[model samples]
Target: MQESATIIDIRHIQVGYGQKTVIGDVTLTAGPGELIGILGPNGSGKSTLLKSLCGLLPYSKGEVLLFGRPLLSMSERDRARQVAYMQQEVQVSFGITALDAVLTGRYPYLHWWQNESPADYAIARQYMSFAGVGDLAQRPLHELSGGERQRVMLAKALAQETPLLFLDEPTASLDLSYQEEIFRYCQQICREGKTVLIVVHDIRLAAKFCSRLILLSAGGILSDGPPSQVVTPEHLYQAFGLQSAVYENYISGQLDIHTYDRRSAGQPGKAIHVIGGGGTIGTIIRALRENAYPVSCGILRQGDMDTAVAMAFGTDNLVSQAFGPIGRELGEQNRQKIAQAHYTILGNLYFSQENLDNLKAAFTAGRLIIVEDSPINSRDGTAGEAALLYRQLTARPETTVMKLDELLLAVEKRSL
Candidate 1:
């Protein structure tokens, strides 16, 4: 292929079985050096699309092009030479050594009736080592663990050394380490100018490793772009009917998903204002939202984890700039929200000079629920100022102090 040329061009393709359409009007283009992830809920035709692109399944409408040529027009050997596809599951009934399985990847290069050469063995061994399955070469496929078998199969696909690689849930049954290992290998391969398209169920893993993402719905592509663009709340809801909070995890520095189900819980029109920061209130926000409570949060910094969770659940949040103290305007806004709420919750949050206003706002609530997982003095970074304020709030007539679990139970009971 020429420089920056498209390796796989799928144009308005529709694939089906026995008059029932599975993939509908899907169009996508992939060039070299790109690692794209296909993500969606089950029965969204992710596997069907992969099979159609490889010409293993017939497309009822539209066409596919490989290397600027029609996919159907290419010979099987030519197609195999250019594309390496790994299916979702491999079942071996007969006994075959792992080494022999990996050697089959060289079939495209060998002519009919041609015997395997020493160079082929070298190439197979090299990829087996690359896939971290070099030691399993002599083991029978049936005797290997699921993870071991997956690595061996991945080595076989890598040994093909094709420009375009299609993997349908290659990490399905693998352990956590093996799943990450496979994605890491794919990342390195993409850097060498090859393209990889993977059907992945783990949205967080795909967001972390894949350069681009294609989100599919029941009908067709819901969104297609970089991870930031494709893994939004709107696209996730449209594709999977999932109400989820998508945010960058502070520790992992990757996009993470927190899903909630609010359908069964009827909306209870009770306003609850939450005061929290430093990632202390994420679980509370989710629990309240899942219980169908009308929730709002305030006095959090712009980049705070609490702010992200509040925004994800469509809460009315009052936020300030990062590293800056809560100003009069935001503090007053939070107080107003707290005064309007039926109940206010103070999460188990560490107090600093910057967020001291959050504790002051809690006193404005008609009824207060204080989540005291840790002692007040332990989280008192304000030289006992916050602890003094917290003690006074808890001493109020309508205040109730409880642990996190008890607080959740109280909220749930109040919802009923």
Candidate 2:
């Protein structure tokens, strides 16, 4: 009775308690195989929206259609047959066995006084095994640990076998590994063509697993799309009032989110120019910006990791074509930014003929700080030609050579 996938079409829905509207105006539709994560700050109506969809909370405005039928008109039995919901908290009786608790999901298909069927027990056991809690089926629900109880709840929801599932913070009680496992389970079920809408507070976790994301703010939808589009700095700021750096982690190949606060940061001062390349500019630029130094990045190739990190940090990029030799126009532009900077930092970079212009441009800085994170001999890609110029720059009176930490402290202490 509950083994078919479904679609939900909600139009201009307004949900609230009495006169206080929580979701003022919202419209969304979900189809089979979609694992959608609803994310927002607290009081943004994430849980309320899930409840409204599962018919636990009524919408006073507009309509919700489930499987092409109006949700309000569906009988309670029919609604339960189509959707399975796992809420945030559960209060079961003291002595109910885990298997018995999961059997409750099969009640919609039974008569008023009927006991659970053999088939129901089988289904309950199946999902309990799937949720890695089959061995605890004989244990009392109240006697189980929080994570065990959570897995039992998951088993119950899975036993429903409904086309659409809603999980509201189901992983709240689970540890990090189990937290990820729950989402992984949801993803697997959705791949089998079920629809799942999860309400999660962990934004990055949601981004890593959910096929799509909906960010709510001020009782309305702020952003809705794939993680790459919705988990952006601007959207996160609008939704949570957080100043965040959202970037693709080069190593993990996943989105990395770091939140920063400028409240205690220094006032923006004279601009610093960063000569960044070969993946060494990220830490340098990030440190400069965190201390409220106005920094610009230059001579970065179009597709370099440097460009990506710079864009994420909102640095002004002085551009050059990727894999192309520095041209006169772009070389002049690099010099101009270098000349205007109060101090310029030359990052530890691989030196080559194509990027020789960047080394030359570093000489234009009124004052210079060169990061010697690695030995210059190994970084020379121009057969010692670029290293010779680097040696000359290090010899200048205004040039200061320091390790990365020393440079960071100098900036933090405001010592030129």
Candidate 3:
């Protein structure tokens, strides 16, 4: 394939089984070095679309072009030389060594009745090692574990060395480590000018690795673009009926999703103000939202992890700038939010000079719930000033200090 050449062109294709249409009027253009992820819920035509692209499943209408040539006009061997396909599962009825399975990838390059040459074996072994399955070369394909067999099949596909690769849930059976390994390998190979289209169920993994994403829904394309464009909360809800919090994960520095069940019936009741940061208030915010409470968070810094979670859940939040102490203006805003709320929750966050105003504002709550997982003195970094204020707040007649578990139970009981 040359630079800027279109590797695969799927135009207005319709695919189905018997009389039922599973994919309808989908058009996509993939160029060299693009790693596209096919993502959607089950029965969304992810697998059927993949098979149709490579000719394993017939399309009812429209055309598929490889290198601007009609796909249906290509011979089986000719197409195999340009495209490599890995199915969802591989079952070997007859016993075959793993080495033999991988060596079969080279058949497209051989003549009829011709045996594999030494160079073909070398290529197979090279790919087996690359897939981390070199040690299992002598083992029987049927005797290998699920993950091991997946690696062997991946090796087979890699040995084909085609410019266009189609994988259907290739990492479905692998562990966490191997799942990342397979995606990383695909990324590495795509940099060398390979175009890969893979069907993936793990949204986080796809967001982290794929160059672009295609989301399907009910036999049609829902969204298609880079991960940031395709994995939005609105798209997820429309495609999968999921209510999810979509945000950038701080640790991985990638987009991540946290899905929740459908919201409970009835209007949101009882405003609750959450004053916390340093990643302590995520669960509290989620719990309140799940129970149909109007939740708001305040006095969090712009780049705080907790703030990101709050924004993803559509919480009303008042945020200050990062690395700066809360100003008097924002502090007053927080106090007003606290006054309006029916109840307030103070998460078990460490006390720092930058957030001391948050501690001061907690005094305005009519009914205060303090989560104290550890001693206050241990987490106080503001000399003795924070601990002194904390003592005064806890002594108030409306304050209730309890562990996280007890506080959650109390909230649940109150909601009931």
Candidate 4:
């Protein structure tokens, strides 16, 4: 890739309508070949700020310099060659082929009576390829799916052959797969020595794809840095009114954001470990965390909401893997973690032969407290031996066995 330069410099730009400043004194810079994602809640002036960049909205204060020159002083042709703006939702108010839509980007270089030269067509085709819509050139905008339409819009922007591109909510209409595809395409665009500034709501997608993220919140620039540095949990909560626990993926080793609906009222006084899967222990983890108990979980890979919830609580003790059938390794690891806990409560989950070893580990460690009737269905598909072992523990003089409600009541009584 070529070395990209700083093509956009907005220093202290205040944008708004007459007598009202929606976004005030904003300063941001986008370098050549940089993909920057702008994030903020609705009505936070993200769109207004973007409009200010293209001279569609007049600035109330400050200056915008394009390639070291004042934006207001640039000629139409010069400005068109430098910047391309793609709106989030493009309406097909008129029936136009995708090719025609893209060809409009060449108007800046055309005379009133002149036909589009072969170079313009070649440029349009190349951009369509760059945006992954070369095959849809003949299709009408109305005939495209949401994702396809978005790509076509992107192709139009790219067709302008500009170093700077602005996109507002480019992935808003896309499904998960399409959302990822669009972001990946944008990354490729940046790699080609073009700077693309986009507004996106999915912080995780932006973090994974964009080189930098600019968080707009509370009428100001909250943060501007690389994704890892800028999209911290604190910043996310502040910017989007979301409370999240950030985690490093056990498999991907990348950052994942898990938003929690309820906040722990106080710091947990004790660290506990949970052992169960198949959505059996998710509520338990939440309850423990809500009651100010620090909890860790493990060995439940995919199809386990428990593992997903554990990530949300920022549980320090999580051992998870991708989706697959439960295996001996995971069972053994879960058993080891459970054995290490100060106390263990068996969730109302059926036992399986595969996980029988995990239960046995708890038995060997003499730490077993089973939820009532957990082993009733154990013989069907679950680990009946584990259930039997649990029954033995409950029957023992030292073990405590209680139902879920009883457990909560006991905790409440103790608190009083």
Candidate 5:
């Protein structure tokens, strides 16, 4: 709360233990009211980057600026006053009460012979309540469970009352509910004007709560942006070697991630064209990509669910305006893509005047796959125009109508 516009300015800093460098050329800046999640695979230096900040580890090169001043110039107390750090694990000596542990946060404000004052006790108690550990204040830290001890440690950090907070893998070892609770608390703390940098493993939790995300890989920063940009499949694959899909959850308005095994089906097997829109065809598109069918989706309106699914897979896409009929040029492009693919899929999309051209383009493919789960008349929305076209499509000798499971099996067999 007592800093300039930027709370932390980390220049190109390199940190390591003895001979092996863990983080290199890492440069990032943090502002007030930001909950920034540091994420990456194991051995990606997430913890190393954090340790280098508060003088826990010496940076061989580059510099760190706290409140626009050199980090190296700050005294130990000055550094402690500026930032509160809760490390991944704490090894407390036996018989130390939790309240006494929380009081350690007040050392920077005390003289060598001074004891924790009444006001300090009040502050410690308040934070313990905030961390949901007020009842455990008098209990010995060694007697508490790991989750309880972690919460008490959080209370200690909060009790420090610093402008910036750094927590490394704070929730990684906790139960699912505690993990979410800690993140929610961090979000609230950011709203009240503290900058929090958290090293996290749960991408979904980070995407749900953090304002910004920084993904690190192999001693370097791989991606840094808002959650929407940093939580993409490409970023995940690059950072964690995982095949994944990231999309906005409709109910929670948070980013949702689903990881898939890429052992064999992830390889490019066949080329396919998808014509879909509305809320339909997202699962179909995912199924195609999961099974390693190179997919091109077209004429999906900008914000449509179908468009989001296609983009998440990094598929070739021909987009249309968010709210409009498909235009001549785009429609023609869709047909061209259909012609180029080994097969084209006509999803069980509800027909509407806006996207009737997508249905018309289905006829362009040499082999067409139709997914129909309901009666045609029930889904037709273009005044029976789509029904007439669909009937003709089903009548074609080259067209095959299959249920979702059957289609996946057929594609798997064809790939073999």
Candidate 6:
């Protein structure tokens, strides 16, 4: 049901059109300063929920209240001023300048026949800059890229200066970089004490960015809460008919997911060591940790992922050393740790001359080195020497392009 504490509340709403019911018995709320993401497969009534909450669609049953008052009872200008709704793929037929488009957000504050005040223009300019499109103020709607247009649309909504902003697939057509940019912009807005509700297709991005996630099924809410609590394997299976594995990030302490393919059944293979800077080792650490491996790493500064995971697991197996770039002393410490490991793997990291001494220790110590597909380069003279040693150890493979799964299998088999 509706929550009084929430800025926007929907209580067991049954929304439909004409004689067809699109959503049934749905209820969710967005509290102040919360960024809530609505997620599910297509035709799951996600759009219907957005429409119902925005007062664009009438519900057959239940209630929607904005700050304890009925949605229908609110005035049009008051509602528009308090709520900003941006639908997915909204068409802009005219060749209007982006500035004019965004300035439309001030309509609720202006009289029907009166002109826009200087304050309205200032707000439009501020929002345009905040959305990172100040230079595109004069650009026409049709002249922008898909991502640029999406950002302009967001700027227009933000110009509305509403307490609550609703977006439908705000990052739908954008590339990964633009998708993150949009999510970052939304996060910034939420930080400013505004509540944002967005529909998202990327589950991982939603999990990382949204404070709360609401999952929709056939026509109603299947689950709702923090992403860690709401988006689960069972909920995903129920919504999209897919199996997935959920794990906690060792560093960020957030939920991360990996889909499971039933066609390739069986458990993941053995323990392995990831030897790299702690800064970028978080994902690898969490992935291995979830697979039930006794993982360890070191030669890290105090604030790296290695230190975080070590403290989190408190297994006493993982060791963290001082900060600074890897040098002779650091290499000696890492060498001892690698000597005890079954295998050592490296990611796409640039090797420093100072670190070359350390990598050479792994080679002379007879440690199996598994590197990514990237070419190895070194500022230090030891890389070429280390390469020769690695060549002898992995002679059959001859290349550093081993598939992650295949590499894990080989390690497990050799250890057995």
Could you say which candidate leads in TM-score? Answer: 2
- Model 5: per-residue Cα lDDT at residue 160: 96
lDDT of 3 by residue, 83-172 (tens): 999999787855799999999999999998899999999999999999999999999899998899998999999999899999999999
| Over 4 Å off, model 1 | 1-3, 381-384, 412-416
**Deviation in angstroms for 299 in model 3?**
1.6
What digit string (tens of lDDT, one per residue) describes model 6 on residues 36-118?
99999999888888888878888899999887778988888878878899889878757898898899988888898988889
Among residues 3 or more apart in sequence or in different chains, the pairs in candidate 5 whose N, CA or C atoms overlap within 3 Å are none
How much is 359 displaced in model 5, in angstroms?
Answer: 2.7
Candidate 4, superposed: residue stretches over 4 Å from native = 1-4, 263-416
Lowest lDDT 10-residue stretch of candidate 5: 407-416
lDDT of 2 by residue, 1-416 (tens): 33324499989999999999999999999988999999999999999999998899999998999988999999999998889999999997988999988999998889899998889999999999999999999999999989888989999988888989999999999999999999999999999888999999999899999999999999999999999999998998888888788889888888988777655675776799999887998887777767777889998988788888888888888878888789999999999988888999999999888998899988888899999988889999899888899999999999999999998887777665
Instruction: Residues 23-118, candidate 4: write the lDDT tens digits.
Output: 977888888878998888887788888888887788878999888889988887778878889986687845798888889888877888988999
* Weakest lDDT window of 10 consecutive positions for candidate 4: 407-416
**TM-score winner, 1 or 6:** 1
Local distance difference test, each candidate: 0.89, 0.89, 0.91, 0.74, 0.89, 0.72
Over all chains combined, what TM-score does candidate 5 have?
0.88
| Candidate 6 backbone overlaps, count | 0
Model 5 clash tally, residue pairs: 0
Backbone clash tally (model 3): 0
Q: List the residue pairs that clash in candidate 2.
A: none
**Model 6 worst lDDT window (10 residues):** 311-320
Candidate 4 matches the true fold with a TM-score of 0.71
TM-score of 6: 0.66
Off by over 4 Å in 6: 1-4, 264-416
State candidate 3's TM-score. Answer: 0.93
